[model samples]
Target: NRLLLDLETDLFATCCYVDVDMEEGSAWYVRAGHLPPVLRHPDGRTEVPESEPGPPLGVIRQTDFPMSPLRLQPGTILALTTDGLVESVEVDIEDGLNRLAAGLAGSDPSHLGLVADELLTEANRSDDVALLLMRFDGMDVLPSRESWTVWRVPEAVRHARRYTRRALRSWGVADHTDAALLIVSELVTNALVHTDGQVRLDLTLIHRRLRIAVADNSPRTPIKPTNIGWEATGGRGILLVEAMSDTWGTVPVSGGKQVWSELSLD
Candidate 1:
């Protein structure tokens, strides 16, 4: 609706959204009259995944945009760009796409900026251009696992804080120890207090973020408290987590709901 409103205001816009599945080695994409995504394989072969483009936004009303599938192989680099990156009034869109592919095909995948620079040079860029690159590293490595605990009520909160501290240390993210431990404590406390069964605390450390999840047996959701009172005991727990966490949310799984929070490493 918001996009349609922008189009109604006479702002011509086109976009391409791609959701990559690293594990499955595929991506589901939507091309809204923008350039189709290009996949550069390991063997220096670049190809654009077939996609039907819709009319540019603001040109048509009540348009239906279709999704397309893009399969990714190991060591493949996916390039998504706005038309300016590959198209101009003077150059044919297909030729521009070929130029982008050729530029990326021979370039090293690690340094993506060079590929973009080369493509821009070939394009003789006159308009604004936005380029996004994704290189899918092979999924051959073993997954990492961490220890977690299950407990009920107040006991778990203390245990969670201690466990969180140790986990942060082991992950070499000791800098976030204080804040992350505090955030984990609050989330675990909420799970224990609200649900019946034992609260399961899970922590996973990714490349960019540290994720902490507290799962309980009850389906009830944790409310984000607006009014916080550090002095007045209780009820400001979720608010504290929200303040400390980079991002937080609740997910309802098979047995119950899990309240999770993430803290960025950088």
Candidate 2:
């Protein structure tokens, strides 16, 4: 939102942003004076969801782009496109959207590339057209996931470690138990000490990899310390996480940020 506000005086653009969580079988999107996404279900039913959009980018300052959520069942196909593909001088936007949805309802989702090409066969040639299509199949073998909310108490770190250890043991990854526990302790402790609002610890085990995630209501990402002397007592949590996990990163969620680290059990 701040980025769009900064551009309010210089540029005019519309955007539709969508984020999909396959594991959760859900999607969240926000439209900024853009077209609503078209969804085709597994049963061949299609509809343009009723989406409330904010003003076009660079048109308003301090605007709140309210997000709309959608549940994506298995074999659901989602389509997002620009006006060139759906609207023309001869056709109204509403009719164009209906036509697009109808076209999507008849296409085969297995051939997404071909489906995209077919959708563009009737696009307005005078303008640039863009289309993005996604088919959510959901996970065939869902990973084992457990989440625990951390209370604002002194024993939070210990409790986090205990949870991590138990989860790792149950998943048959006891070999990496110590390392996972340490990583969880550091991440949860950092979230408790540095941020406010609710804190949560999540563990996901899929195959031979284990993922540890700590979510907090703050959007500020953890910063890594460049240099630490012998006397330094803090600013090493992120560093420890990096050193212990095969991969680690942070992502923005609905109202907060999630710091996640992945470990390979092999």
Candidate 3:
């Protein structure tokens, strides 16, 4: 939305955004004046999801894009496309959409590339045509996650450390408990001191890697201090988190951002 406003032009665009969570076997999607996505179930069934959509981009300021959630089973295929493939002067869009769904139901999902080619062969190309298809096979080994809401009290940092220690021990990764606790403390303290709204600490164990994530209702990314004097007592939380973990990064989420650190148990 902010991106469209920055353009400052009369031209607007439609969009369909999707976010998939493999661990949870679910996805969230929002359509901005775009066609509903088509889904093919594992049993060779097809249907278009019915979800409300927001206005086209650059047409509304501060518009709320409502998201719809879809639970994905193994072997489910999701298809997104532009209206050019389903709308033409001679054909109604509803009929065209039904034809597209029927085509998907008959195609083989094992060969996605071939399926895409076959679908495009029948498209009405008077305008631009685009297609995106994804098969959700799901994760073979799901990660174990534990989350704790950090209160805005003085004992928040200590409580976060204790939670991390317990989770690490339960996951049989207690050997790295000290480092994990330090990372959690630094991250939780940073979020509590610097950000606003509810703060959460999440510990995830997948295979032999452990991921420590701190999420808060703020979009600001953590800044790494370039220099630190010997007498400096603060602004070292990010540095400590970086040094303690193999990799650390931040990603934007629905309402805010999540800062995460990953350590390899190997």
Candidate 4:
């Protein structure tokens, strides 16, 4: 709102702004008398956001532009361009837009820089041609990440360790692999060994701290069984976790319990 007021009074120009909410992987944007941006999702989905546009900036002293919101999933692509790119004496803007969308669809999603260059090739010389391409790397997906996967008993044990190790290494927390692999293996093992229903492992990494969490549909909390003698098999995993990890704990969650541990990167 404050931004809209400023745009109305401060300057005379056609522009757009996207304010991204990192946690939600969504954006709030205002298109004040500018061409709408083209959005392409990883699934080959393409769209142009629809919102009522206010007059160009400075057209009215106290203008109010409605800000629209949209999801920005990981691997999503956004292409913003000036009107000059589509406006040509020889071509209709509609034709230009169709061409642009087709070009974006055909271009390699992995190499969007090259796609942008190819787009500029079709630009008109009658006015300024400007383009900006953005690809989203959502915090919950990659760069900073999280994952949910079910575990089924003995088979899941190996998979859980492998997944945790690979995910940590992908996060560039190689130092954590030795400790995290052991910790996650323990947690996943406990979840499967004791639980009856669904078992899941959720992994998250943030700011050099790696959190390994396992949730399972068991009402019971983890504890060393008195009858199981402390040997190679008796609750040694938890003991190893306590000694090797920076911190560890358990909490009650809906229909189950969640055990989590945090490892320090530095």
Which RMSD values do the candidates have, in order?
Answer: 6.8, 3.0, 3.0, 14.5
Instruction: Please give each candidate's TM-score.
Output: 0.63, 0.82, 0.83, 0.50
Question: Least accurate stretch of 10 residues (summed lDDT) in model 2?
Answer: 1-10
lDDT of 2 by residue, 1-266 (tens): 56755755576789999989989999899999999999999999998999789989877776789899999999999999999998999998999999999999999988999999999998999999999999999998889999999989988898888877888788788888888988998999999999999999999988788899999999998898899998988988899999999999999987899999999988
Better of 1 and 3 by lDDT: 3
Per-residue alpha-carbon lDDT of model 1 for 1-266, expressed as tens digits?
A: 25666655767778888888766788899877788888899888989777788777777777788888887788899988777776777778898888888888889888877767766676545777777888898576433446576666447677778877887787788987888888877887777666787677888876757888888889888876667666877888888888888889999977688888888888
- Compared with the true structure, the alpha-carbon lDDT of candidate 4 equals 0.79
Q: Which stretches of candidate 1 lie over 4 Å from their true place?
A: 6-8, 58-61, 140-210, 213-235, 242-260, 263-266
Query: Evaluated with TM-score, which candidate comes out highest?
Result: 3
What is the descending TM-score order?
3, 2, 1, 4
Score candidate 3 by TM-score against the native: 0.83
Model 2 bad stretches (over 4 Å) = 1-3, 6-12, 19-30, 51-54, 57-71
- lDDT rank order: 3, 2, 4, 1
- Candidates in order have lDDT scores of 0.78, 0.91, 0.91, 0.79
Expressed as tens digits, the lDDT of each residue in 117-193 for candidate 4 is: 89899999779888999888776544366676765745787887777777877777777588888888788877777
Residue pairs of candidate 2 with colliding backbone atoms: 8-58
